[model samples]
Target chain A: MIALDYSQFLTFEPQHHWRIGIAIYLFLGGLGASMGFIAALYKHIFKKDDPSMFAWSTLLGVLLVNFGGIFLILDMFVWESFLHGHITEIFKVLLAFFGAAVFNGNFHPWIQWGANFIALFSLFGTLWALSQADKAAILNKLGFLVKIANLLKPLQSVWGWGTIIFGLAVAAYTGFLLSVAPAIPAWSHPLLPVLFVISALSTATAWYMLWTYFAKGKDEETQKVREHVGHQVEWADIALIGLEILAIGAYFNYLYYAYAGGKYVFHQMLSDMGFVIGFLLVGLLIPWILEFIAAKKHIRILVPLAAILVLFGGFLLRYYILHYGIYTYPWPS
Target chain B: MQEQQNKQLPNWVFVIDLNTCVGCNACMAACAQENQTPYWNEKWRTKVEQAEVGKGDNIGRIFFPRLCMHCQNTPCYYACPTGATYKTPEGVVMVNQDLCIGCEACVTACPYDARYRYDYEDVEHNKQLFGEEFSIHQLPHIDKCTFCYHRITKGLEPACVSTCPTDCRMWGDLNDPNDPVAEIVRSGRAKPLAVHLGTDPKVFYVGLDTLPAPAKEEAE
Candidate 1:
């Protein structure tokens, strides 16, 4: 049987739709993990009297994101019954069980530990995929691994310096993935990864706030913990707003340069991308504004909605970057 | 002094004049034969593409002869696991048949979709005809255009260049100012594939009228 060009199946073309799908995938992955991290961290930091909601919510978010990988089957061209070798076997089957634990809301220690391990592994898997494309020229498979290492050898120290920073920042890694692809004007900023890290934190904080606010039938100490944690989340939202502004401004600056050079980049950005209107304005900008207002007024109700919008917008941002970076303009005259 | 040092090192380059190429698949045929590559398999180290842009009767089509660009900083090299891919001292981006574990890392690393790994039967057929020891179960390695490194090492022009019924293909040291290939590039008539990617490709197209857009959407 002829091997189907797997590349075609992966992208599922016409450009725009591919972008949206990738955005959704990244969004699910990032949002889930971020939500989990913030919930756990806040409970740990604040030393809340309540049993940690961090463990449960974090698990929920992570499992939901890993569940998104089910869509990968829709793309496999061969659809052959052939067993995957160890190279492709990096995506372990155990991830499913860990994901299940999150949704089940188990407070068991073993479950939380297993879920955390899987979440961390899945994050590395995503990073490994991105690192797969770091080379400058991609011809011939000669001493390929060695050649790749030669290229990366110099960057090893740099990678080492930033590993913990990257870990703490969480989904900020997704931003670095886009930044490496210089082709996309919107995603090619030095600050893109930094912005992603902040968003990850924001998503984490928001999940914690929601979990805490909803917590009831608890002791007085637990109730006090819930309200205190909610206040901390409110502050995080403020920081997210600042980061979002910087990311947007830098991206637009890149667009200006790309447009001014008569690269026809602006046309693609406006016409092709639904993010500017759908994600940026409605999802991110408006929600951010409302959250700012709500923060000042100490209005907790609007904060969740704002968090929902911010998270939605973040996914859209990732979608456009991944998709648009891959899309090419028709060649010059 | 730098120019003299540059002359001592082999700066690999392929220059294709779009005007003379007839899209006859002569270079493709020659490359496969010389490399002992399997036909009807996805193992063409060099392939000919008929590329055109613009609309209507005014459209101009050019024969695009493509191989690995042998970039100064190659992306595919790093993606490999068994260390099968690397550049030779002769500056050709090449594969070591002995070392290649055929992991398909370079295949994904390539944005151009140039690399293809053939199965054991195909590899055996190619190796058998050359009177070399070969196997069927485990295929040798990923195959691509070596710029005919074997012939070039023996001080011969590539089979593709020599077999071209039309003298459209040019191969030489691109680093040298005195070389015709360098002169052509300095004259601004030659263009590299995906210059925006910053691969600094050695293969340059002369008389290219249009950019060949990737028919397949995926980058690799």
Candidate 2:
């Protein structure tokens, strides 16, 4: 008897609907916004005496959150829907089921909702902090706004912690967004969220360091403050970089041992030697080593370069995850 | 209440007899015509895939008609952020075009690669078949095989089943024990694709044992 050919029943084509440009922009925006929120919180809690640092950090956070929100809107298929008021229906449906779905383990909706909530909250918080700092002197000229800022001074600490929590949620939400996709075996891991959070933190730290070193004024007082904060951030980044490496290792190990499909996808991803070498070696490993050296030798130039590499690696990580996510073809039984 | 609801629901299933399939691709053409899908769009709601197996004198080819599996526990349904893709009481999975944000979440969540984003312009030619208010062509929406829900609900067989030249496709309510498709499925001869994933797909295949292994090089 002649056997039927079962394997060729269907041809599986890898989808490229979610382009690399969207992935990179979304990743950068989310990372920048979250980092800005964290930096503002850190300044408020630890360096309250330095009003100038708090103002700068708050301004950076506001700018990043707004930019991130813009990129997210651009990535939507019908972004004009938001402006035309068509998105209200989507919002209405989500609002109706938000509580039930969250309790029922439907976290996809929650992740999207949480991201939006955090973006708005962080934006408002940073702007409020900026007005209170009055570094630009624009807010001080507005008498009514200055009174409101003073009235809200007692609750500033609460807002600071709230922004920090929401920022972290935004970071974790990016990972959760991709992990929920069951088709992509490579991204469906439980540890994907952990890996993403660590990467976000490392990238955030790197961005803060870069901004402090390069974007700040070159006056004697500002230079002294930048040097001090840069040193502290360098140590923090080293620790973040170390944990990021560990997370990456754990993520790959989990994929290799989880199942045949995961293992196959993992090998397939690595087969594209460019991604592994560009993202892992040059993007991650080289930067890690350079950051370590910069920390010990106090090499200012090396620190910024390492920061740039960390950002580059962060972009590549998201790029590779979105572009190379191959759906496991279900072999006919 | 739950028991009453379950009893009221229809159990829809599709049966494909591999022994009778001639790999003629009539079903694919009928589906595209019935759905009014744009000619330029590469993605099809229903498609026939050909696989060549074995080597030398043993070489043989088989045709597999693929579409949305309509699983009992659909991953795409769960992954949808706003409930845009949902399963009806009749066991048919559907995408609500109005609610779909075209985030492609459902597309990525489906293991079958059955769902695709509709990127074509709306042609006015099919307005008579599908009324102007509810034309089949909708831009910037995720689309997949809906089991020909409009026709099925109207007591008509799906276009693919009706147009099949070899009578290889079977469509019926699986809850009826006397239904031929249900009988074939209950006979334990039919196998669901990716049973290990636990999707509990409604579509089942018979005569799989006679099918040759897919060529390894061509699998990519």
Candidate 3:
């Protein structure tokens, strides 16, 4: 038998820097924005006759992008400088350093730059679309803004496609952020990005389903639109959930066959019943099954429950991944 | 003389004589004092790790003094988003406090677990060590052993090396063929920790043979 060195095994607790707040922000923000962008794209590509769906998706996408941005800013340590009256100086330094690092092609800075650009584009695009619809009285009164909105009318497809690409990038970037941490063997995998993208899309579909269900109108024409959108979202979510399960299985299998460090992480993750049972079984598996059943039976109530469960599972997935990341003990050689 | 030229060489490396190490932890204390690290935080730039080998009567204890290996391809350096952690021209890995965002990416990337986040409590000590404006700017930056960059650049030995009672620690240039550390390494006895990891660690253990061999894989 291999003699395990039980002696002198030192494992330190990681400081709570990137905690639940940041995880939630990354998950919800990425999912909401991406789902909204995808919905808008679908509207442009297939349902160009009904531009109202595009308007609703754009509004939700902009709100989510801005909401996620608030949390992100709060998570930064640089924000604390505001209390000491050095916020300006600190921000200037941060911008200068991060700007230079982004230019140099560092992974983290590039992720930050990409996320910011996507959020800004989504926000501006949504507002521009809303303004052109004459929904906002403030925007409608501005003559110059009206002309710019008219000018952008020709590039609606380009704008829609741009948001889709950026939204997908935003979803994947969260995984890349975690995978870059060399200490966390469980997270430092190629499959993590793939897994995150699938999860994000799954959650996005869930959110859209809930939104369409709640926003359903009493009129026959409006009801038809809601039912049609709902049907498409349900099918997409079922596919995304299937892909998520497959990716997760592959991820665990990879870890099990990996080196000693990877095996240790895999074992740790398996042993945590809260994660395995609560997050994986109750959250993901149950929801997936419900969605499948609901689609077949055409159960409207089951759809919302399944959607909520998926959203919960998405949050828990991120929580467990971040919180349970155990740094392998540096064993004596 | 060749010895005189070797003494002035760059590319400093640490030679740790494991056979002579008594695990006194004097180096740990000296490092903490020299760096002005807070007492509450258990984060250490250098410390002694002890493990026992063999069964019952044959059991013997081995002491390993741990510190930053100052790797050639440092994971922390590559992991830093803002290039806050960098390698000096003299081959010393140091954190540029002004640039560090306290994201703790370097702290997580370090294989040896050498880097630590300087929290709000350590602010006063950091200000005293690095000055007011620099400390204010670098409030929560990651910190680790810089191979005593301030002392080494000023032609003084590191506190840990100087304060070690057993004289197990040796700091000198690895580039110089005549340097004692270079000679010990060339003699085919010295070995770096985790050589298989490809970190190319500068710190070498001269009497690693005295310690127990790594555990072998168990039979199914």
Runs in model 2 lying further than 4 Å from the true structure: A2-12, A40-51, A79-111, A135-148, A215-228, A331-333, B120-134, B208-220
Query: In candidate 3 chain A, what residue range of length 10 has the lowest lDDT sum?
Result: A1-10
Which candidate ranks first by lDDT, i.e. highest? 3
Per-residue CA lDDT of model 2 for B40-71, tens digit only, reads 55668887776666676555566777789999
lDDT of 1 by residue, A1-333 (tens): 112221121111122222444456556656665664554344334444333353345435656566643432222211111232332222222232344335534333222333344456444323322232232123113365445545654554343223223235436545543443333345455666676766666666666656665665246766676777777777777677677777767766666675332234445656664867876786667887877888798776887787777767776677666555533321221
Give every prediction's interface RMSD.
16.0, 5.7, 6.2
Off by over 4 Å in 1: A1-25, A36-51, A57-166, A182-191, A238-242, A259-265, A289-303, A327-333, B1-10, B28-64, B78-85, B94-145, B148-159, B173-197, B207-220
Residue A327 CA error for candidate 1 (Å)? 4.8
Q: What local lDDT score does residue B68 receive in model 2, on the 0 to 100 scale?
A: 91
Worst 10 residues of 1 chain A by lDDT: A5-14
Residue A15 Cα positional deviation in candidate 2, in Å, after optimal superposition? 2.2
C-alpha local distance difference test of each model: 0.56, 0.70, 0.71
For model 2, the TM-score of its B chain against the native B chain is 0.87
Q: Can you write out model 3's per-residue Cα lDDT over A81-150, one digit (the tens) per residue? A: 5655667646854674457544656654434554555555575557535534433335556677667667
Question: What is the TM-score (0 to 1) of chain A in model 1?
Answer: 0.62
Q: In terms of docking quality, how is candidate 1 classified? A: incorrect
Among residues 3 or more apart in sequence or in different chains, the pairs in candidate 2 whose N, CA or C atoms overlap within 3 Å are A4-B210, A4-B211, A4-B212, A8-B51
Q: Candidate 2 residues A111-215, lDDT tens each?
A: 455556555556556654654654333555667767767776677666666666666777777777777566567678888778778787788888777877776
Over the stretch B162-217, how does candidate 1's per-residue lDDT look in tens digits? 99888788877766778886788778888876676787788887655433333221
